[model samples]
Target: MTIKEKINKFISEKKITHAEIGRGLNTSQQNVSRILGESGKVSLDFVVWLACEYPEIDLEKLIRDSDHVSIVRESPATYQKPRLKEKALEEIGAVLDKYM
Candidate 1:
């Protein structure tokens, strides 16, 4: 599933309303709806946070979609940093484990 699809699915599964997620993430409810339905664009970290929070969610697919949205589920965490090397980051993610 794409990132958007994963987010939508997760939101539905979690029974989280758009307004509720927006409130939790400090975003707009309309924006949240637009994002999941492919009516907007968001940053990469937001999508990454979604993947990290909802490990079962498929973010790769969502980000690759034509809509280009990176936002996912309504987890309270945030993406703090990005590394240059994929291997290094992968190792870090593995070591950190929680955000992987």
Candidate 2:
């Protein structure tokens, strides 16, 4: 199934309204309706936000149009902090320190 089809199926199965989705994403109900509507183009940023908000939905597999969409949660121990993010945080801290 296509991503839109999968998303539509998910919405139907979950009995979730567009307003609820909009609330979760901090967007308008109209915007959600547009996104879910036929011929509506789904953006990468929208997909990322949707995935982050609704962890239950396996968007990656849906994007690939995989038949089996499963949620695989990695352990915190298995998660590694990115050095770039660390450096950015350090830089922000330095800036704040300088200002304060």
Pick the TM-score winner.
Answer: 2
Residue-pair clashes per prediction, in order, are: 4, 0
lDDT of 1 by residue, 77-99 (tens): 34333422343345335544544
Off by over 4 Å in 1: 51-100
**Each model's lDDT:** 0.54, 0.60
Candidate 2 weakest lDDT stretch, 10 residues: 71-80
Model 2 per-residue lDDT tens digits across residues 1-100: 6767777777777777899888877899999889889978776556555555555444344555357533322322232334433433443355446555
